[model samples]
Target: GGGKPLAPKNANNAAKNSLRVADIGAGTGNLSIMLLERGCEVVAVEPNDAMREIGISRTKDKNIKWVRATGLESGLEDSGFDWVTFGSSFNVMDRSQALKESHRLLKPQGYFSCMWNHRDLNDPIQEVAEEVILELVPNYTRGVRREDQRPVIEQHKDLFDTIIYIEEDFYFHQNIETYIAAWKSVKNPYWDLETSEGQELFDKIAYQMRHKLPSEFDIKYTTRCWSAKARN
Candidate 1:
């Protein structure tokens, strides 16, 4: 899970030609827009109203319909979509149940793909950021990845078969302030910069970077995707 989940690149020619999709846990509709750009009609399901609104406005995809729903109970009919995608939000979900729901939603032989933009901490600047973050919150754990739940999906082989992939590079560049803001903007459950302790740590990170780093930084990321072929 890295670099904007470049798994979308692996979309078969048929998916590119036309696809009807259910974008489960679609936060900010980033992936939905990507799908819409490919001429896919999408339904973006998100539980948080604020997050859903942000996604709806951000994507502005006419092909996308936003719905308030969680991954396990999407409030959508069965067998309606060719694909059910969990973009960057699969690990946090009750994935076993979510996968069952995805199976129910997808048409016969439909696809399920989960993707993540893994931080390219391998780079020096990114590594520095990681160091600062880990130093501040010793107990902070990165959210789970596909590997964490792959067994659950695999064990219940009647639902789907895992799709394998090779790592792909995805780069995004931003100024120092923008980078700081992005981290600050991370939601509360993930990391709460608004809290006193959190704010102090964030300030420390800001001070170090602002004093020591250049205005702009190039971030390298690795996008990983775990896809599956859904079964009845």
Candidate 2:
């Protein structure tokens, strides 16, 4: 038994009380919950069924609406939101199209933001993990998520202005089991996990994590963010 899923509050009321935000590709609603806790009325959009299901479950008690949609084509109303955000999901989208959609969703001068939490591969433990993956999956790539986002965001100067970028490093401590599970959730498009080589790579990583690492360890990460306001 849960309360009714959060619906969009009245426009004037939302504008008076808080910001209305569209969280595109809101995997598991992590960022949505954060926004909700900070008094924003959030609409969380996710295209994948499994991920959306988990997201709905996670935010059932929170006041956040979950929508089935993609970042490039979120089926939200025009000029209805004070902010549009993509949390670590922007790299998977066509940046140009996504920016257009975000601009369409934002109110006048509303903000648009995309951010990623990047693991510090240079960390001692992470370095070993990376070496293991590279040894097995020789073609492993970090993809666009690691690349600088300024050039692409700047490309859409017509849609947005006043680009603001920030980066900060932090550390998280977790058990070996939890860390391994986190790795499993990262589905790399190029990595053919059905192959025997893929299985071996995972098995080897798990073995190394269980044997080589301590029960609980600190992992370093940098949170990178880019934001801009609607041009018109």
Candidate 3:
């Protein structure tokens, strides 16, 4: 018999008044796909061409509508959505303006959900990975992008209420080769492959990965999920 994956999947029942969600700054449509699977009609607003293309190719569901728009200007209808969410990209946006837009697009009593899957840098393997990055990029700092959303969250506190924060640990296992490849695909890679300095740095990192890291290891992460209702 078939079964659910680690993430819960909801059956499609949109014909029967399913929830609607607008996933702003929906890079690669991961959040949109997940919400669509949960029986929500999702509008994925993205402004970047490369990311939008990948997201379009990855998600072909009828429930998902991809729009080339930023979080600050989603162009969604007023009070039309039951929820608005942002994944890892939230901290990168103008949070105050983003919240204002979120409030405008969501129905009263709807929720704004934000989450980040942060790597467990404290892990020895990850520690080494950071060291490798610093050795190469010299300025790679963990959580540099995430910083803190609290100030912005507070700045717009009047627009939302019933705030809640929850976190959980998750483990993803992969081979060293897969890990290396994944890192290479990361945006603004710590080491530039085209430059001689970057090549030298990558070579060093590669040597470490091949000789030191185990064939298979876990990449642990802490996922933080925060949700607040849209105030009337």
Candidate 4:
């Protein structure tokens, strides 16, 4: 839920040594950590102070450069990175601006990728959770993360070439506490947790989750990704 773990199809390419990567909106360095594990040189850009601090603390012993920057303005060197990636962060940015920034930050023919781990709503466990959400907010939508990114990337045809899309299903096993914590971290577009109604909605969802979910269970998710080569 809270965790966004991605296993790319091109495992060999990902593990190539000395590959320079810029992880935009790199919240708490999840993607950055993965990249480092694969022997990558990472520039993690996160604008949020709290998240960046945690990221720094988490990777203090590792080789990483953390910068305070947004997806639309990474302030990174031009044509410096072999790959520019956004892990569950592209939706929060202006997609067009972010794409331009990605183009600017990557070497000619370098790759640009953005991905999100989406809960499998068709899963039995997720169906129960969805029931709770729709009951509270009937007009609730899954938001931009679920949308196809091809059209937007295609719009920048001058900046990027043909897109490659990947969808892979995986299961994450976790305790109820961890699962609930994931929900807490989520930014639900339909409800504001700062408001009383939002609090009530979360409480209700939590209560139902506690009632419905086992202490330990597996949640199904599909990691959807879109990538393309940046053109000069």
- Which structure among the candidates has the greatest TM-score? 2
* Residue 21 displacement in candidate 4 (angstroms): 0.9
Model 3: how large is the Cα RMSD against the reference? 5.6
lDDT of 2 by residue, 138-219 (tens): 8889899899988988999999888989999999998989888778656466444567877677877788778777888998
lDDT of 2 at 72: 80
Model 2: lDDT of residue 79: 98
How do the candidates rank by lDDT, highest first? 4, 2, 3, 1
How well is each residue in 1-232 modelled by candidate 4, as lDDT tens digits? 1111233345465544467889998988888998888767789999888789989999997769999977887778999988899999889878999999999998887889999989988888888878877886799787788899999999999999868899999999989888887776565565567779887778887888888888988989899999998887
TM-score of each: 0.81, 0.86, 0.80, 0.84
Two-way lDDT contest, 3 vs 4, winner = 4
Ranking by TM-score: 2, 4, 1, 3
Q: Pick the candidate with the highest lDDT.
A: 4
Candidate 2 is scored at a TM of 0.86
lDDT, candidate 1, 1-232, per-residue tens: 1112323444465355467889988878878988887768799999877678888788773767899978887899989988888878787777888888888998887888888777776788877777777776677666566364567678658989756555688778989998887676454353555468777777887777776567897888787877778765
Q: lDDT, candidate 2, residue 190?
A: 48
lDDT of each residue in 1-232, candidate 3, tens digit only: 2211222334433545667888888888777888876777788998887789989999875678899988897778999988889887676667788889999998888888888877787898888887767766677655434565556677787898777788899998989998886665344545666679876777787887777678899889888877778888
Flag the better candidate by lDDT, 1 or 3.
3
The residue ranges of model 2 lying beyond 4 angstroms of the native Cα positions read 1-15, 191-204
Ranking 1 against 4 by TM-score, winner: 4
C-alpha lDDT of all candidate models, in order: 0.76, 0.83, 0.77, 0.84
RMSD of 1: 5.4
Per-prediction backbone clash count: 7, 0, 0, 0
